[model samples]
Target: MSENELIERIKDRNPNEPEFLQAVEEVISSVSKVLKKHPEYHQLRILERMAEPERLISFRVNWLDDEGNVQVNRGFRVQMNSALGPYKGGLRFHPSVNQSILKFLAFEQIFKNALTGLPLGGGKGGSDFNPKGKSDNEIMRFCQAFMSELFRHIGHFTDVPAGDIGVGSREIGYMFGAYKKLQNDFTGVLTGKGPKWGGSAIRPEATGYGLVYFAENMLKSVDKEIKGKSCIVSGAGNVAQFTLEKLIQLGAKPVTVSDSGGFIYDEDGIDEEKLEHIKHIKNVSRGRISEYTEKYSNAEYTEVNSDDDFNPLWQTKAECVFPCATQNEINEKDAKHLTDNKIILLAEGANMPCTAEAIDVLQESKVLYSPGKASNAGGVGVSGLEMTQNRMGVYWTREEVDEKLKGIMKRIHDDCLETVETYELSDHNYMEAANIHGFLKVAEAMKAQGVV
Candidate 1:
């Protein structure tokens, strides 16, 4: 069947899975022609097989709140593919957690992990329990309850899960501890552990630092440099924080960072000192991004009004932007805003942060764009390194791990550029190159493994 027909079938099957369909459509739109070039793929029904998950696990999480009341939340794990190796991905805990969202994330993970060139497959798990305002005890209870079921499914060489979105070191620790308690055995069943334990160095900052490293390579390709450039970075989480930190380390002036509450645009660039404040606020206090204005008089905080068609954060003039906030945060209007403001590049730090329409706007405007699969593969790259360290019972220094991550990002960037050259595509068409290159490995592996 044709790629469009396969997409229509997917939509018909997953009628409510908009995010998963969007992800599949984005990838199929880029790689469909490439798939057509290999008739065996169509004959073997590879596209149809890939569109479906190998395993989709869902469970109910029950925990008690501090107020002596029982609370229940839904948890999920979408083991999308294991063509290359063990199932590897993240566990996100948020109010928006659902089967469709996890499936989208897991599907994206399959390609993102492929781009990293690591022996890891793709999977994602999460729950709808929001940890934003919950106390440590409440969060711990929820994590234990969630892990009690998840433990039965994951293993070191089977499925090594990590953190994402609402899942951080704290949540990972809680879940790992619970798993260890239940199994009565210690293994590398999870990544993103604390440094004192099995976690690798620079794991927390890998995604953000790798993003900058990838961005630098892309900029250099077009005879542009990041030094002295003004940048807009969205999201105040781990990825955004480290993106800001790395930009500062490289002498770039990052002017904005945002959270769900809103965005903060500091006319004065966010320096190391201000970043410390932000880390304390979000990591310690769990406060909103708007609290930034309370300490820094020079910073202006804008509350996000849902009624607005476009986010004002992207309107700020800058040489580049990183939308690390979440998926679909940048709509077509937001992309248009950046293009109109003369934005030079956009590297995604979050999965599928840009919609299809937004991508079209940016590409038409000739903006340098790299998708999350290639740009945000750093986190998984480091997680892969951590798994290695755990297996060998050895740990690498921070500088060693960072160097490895840099090399991985550079390799992914070069892979995209080479694919562009091979396909005779546009100079900066990293999206097509990335989707094609990433999908090639998984497709071949699936073909080799036969019609399972």
Candidate 2:
């Protein structure tokens, strides 16, 4: 059967899994070229096996609320692939978490992990448990309940889960504590641990920093530099915060950051002092983005208008933009606005932040677009470092980890370009290059391991 037929079968087998289907179609389209050139891959039926997960575990998380009410949330872990190494990925906690979302994330993780050139596989677990407005005790109890089942499936040398979205260091600590207590062993089964524990130094900042570093490379490919360029960034969470921090350090003028409520635009750029305020508001106080204007009168905060077809944040004039918020944040309309404003580079910090149509717009407009799988692997790459640190029983300093991360991101950027050259594909879209490169490695590994 043809590659397109495989996609249809996938959709039929996993109905209501649009996110997972989207991810599968994107990568399969890239590898389809290889299948057409070398039909052996088709004869071996690699796509059929690669599209399915090794295992999908779903469980019910039961906990008690502060008021003694029984609360339950559905949790899932989709161990998509382990051809390279143990299952390595993050666990998100949000109301939007579902099997489709986790499957897409895990599928993307497979390619993302492959691009990192690290001995890591792909998996993703999360629940529809929203941590918003939950008391500390309640959150801890909920996490303990979630880990009670998750702990059985994960280990240091098996599947190592990290924090994502609503799952932060706090959630990691709670889950780790529960895992330790239940298993009666303290192991590095989880990443994003507090610094006092086994967490690596630069893991929190890695995704954001890595996004900038890769974007910088993309810029250099065209003889451009970011030293004095204006950047518009979306999201004020962990990824967006550190992205702004690194942009400031690199002498770029990043002027915007957003949250669910809306976004803030600061003409003077987000300085160190202003970034500290943002960190405090986001990481500590958990306030809305509009609060940014309260402290700095010069900055402007625009509340989100749900009726609009696009976010005004992308309509701003800038040379570069980072969509660090969530999936599908940049739709086709947003992409057109970006091209109209001459935003040259877009590197995703969040998984699948750009819709397929949006990507078509950016690539057609000559924007240096990089997919999250290739660009945001820094987070998982550092988690691999944390796993190494755990096995070695020694932790590296912040500077040491930062240098290694920069090197890894550089290699990924170079490898993507090299693979594009080898495949002779139109790299106006870097996703095709990254997807093909990542697919080749994992497909070979799976082929080597046989028809298991």
Candidate 3:
């Protein structure tokens, strides 16, 4: 089938889903060259099912606040294709939760899980209610209400949900409590549980650690390494902190970590003391990152807003860049600045951090740009680990789990390089390699299963 014909068929089937359509189009474009080797996929047109999900679940989450006032929020779970394994992904509970965002995440999870060589499918669930200012009791009540419905759709062997964004250990604990209450069972239906409740020890840091592992693998593809290189990482959340920790362990200096308000630049280097303080402030105390400056003079925190100048970090050259924050955080301007400084490697710790234009700029400059799916699969990959431990009624040691995760990420990195070589693409075309590698697996699965 021609590329235009495949896109038209996808649009005709999923017209209302603009985000889903765009994701499908991008994957098709990346793998169109490789599709010639597999004429069976074109004959079956498995790309159509790849465009639409098997099921989309939308429901209402009604609960009571601390004042006994009723609050209502919309909850969603898009169970994207599960051809490879059971449904697996994180549950993001932010005000930005919607059908479009969940669709894109779930769609991406399908391929992310596939790349891991795990027996897990793709699914994402979340609510639109923000847990920022809510009291503990209020958050518990809301989670209970949300899980009242979600528990019926998820299970240990079927679908497993982990923490994402606003959802953390507290939220996961509450949701798990509610699920146990509803199902009257103690199975590990959800991941990221408290250790006392069957959670993995290093689950929180898996994504960041996996990202660095993938980065190291990508660096090795060019006969280079991350040791002694300076890394600029955004987001002070789980991904950022762990990425910093791993970089520090590997003898790399990470000088930046950001939040929604702004970012901090520490030219002197981010030590363990500073990292511990940031974790306490953001995770335990739930405070802003601007307070980091109050503790250390060398570390300056500035609000990343329209008027704020971004030159401090951008102008300071770095060998590697990891955007662990939200999507679209780095645009064309940011990409140009990094490329101009001779930044050799770029990997996304968050989903789709680099915009399409920014990615284009990176490829033009021949920077090793690894997409989030391949770079940040550690989170979901470890989530799958949690599921495995749960099913076997056995938990692996932190070292054991981390070893498996590193191996998986290394394989993914090598696979990306092998894919580029097979397709005769450029050295820096990580996106194409990742997209095609992930697409071919799911596409072949869809073909074997036949059109639904």
| Residue-by-residue lDDT tens digits, candidate 3, 1-452 | 68898788777866676555656666788887878888877778666667677888899999999888999999988888888877898899899778877887898888888899888888888989999999999999999999999888888777888999999899999999999989899998899998777998789989999999999988987889999999899888889989999999998998888888877888888888889999999988999988899999888777666554233455457899998987767777778889989999999999877767788888898898888989999998888888888888898889999999999999888888888899998765778888888888888787777676
Q: List the residue pairs that clash in candidate 3.
A: 85-121, 86-121, 262-304
Model 1 lDDT at residue 283: 88
- Model with the higher TM-score, candidate 2 or 3: 2
How badly does each model clash, as a count of residue pairs? 0, 0, 3
lDDT of 1 at 43: 91
Report the Cα lDDT for residue 169, model 1: 91
Q: Which regions of candidate 2 are displaced past 4 Å?
A: none
lDDT of 1: 0.93
* lDDT pick, better of 1 and 3: 1
lDDT of 1 by residue, 1-452 (tens): 77778889999999999999999998888886687588888898877787899999989889999999999999998889999999999999889989889999999999999999999999999999999789999999999999999999999888999999999999999999999999998998999999998898999999999999999999999888899999999999999999999999999999999988789999889999999999999988888888888999889998888689999998998998999989999999989999999999999999999999999999999999999999999999999999999999999999899899999999999999999998888778999999999899999999999888
Listed in order, each prediction's TM-score against the native is 0.99, 0.98, 0.95
lDDT minimum window of 10 residues, candidate 1: 28-37
Worst 10 residues of 2 by lDDT: 420-429
By lDDT, who's the top model here?
1
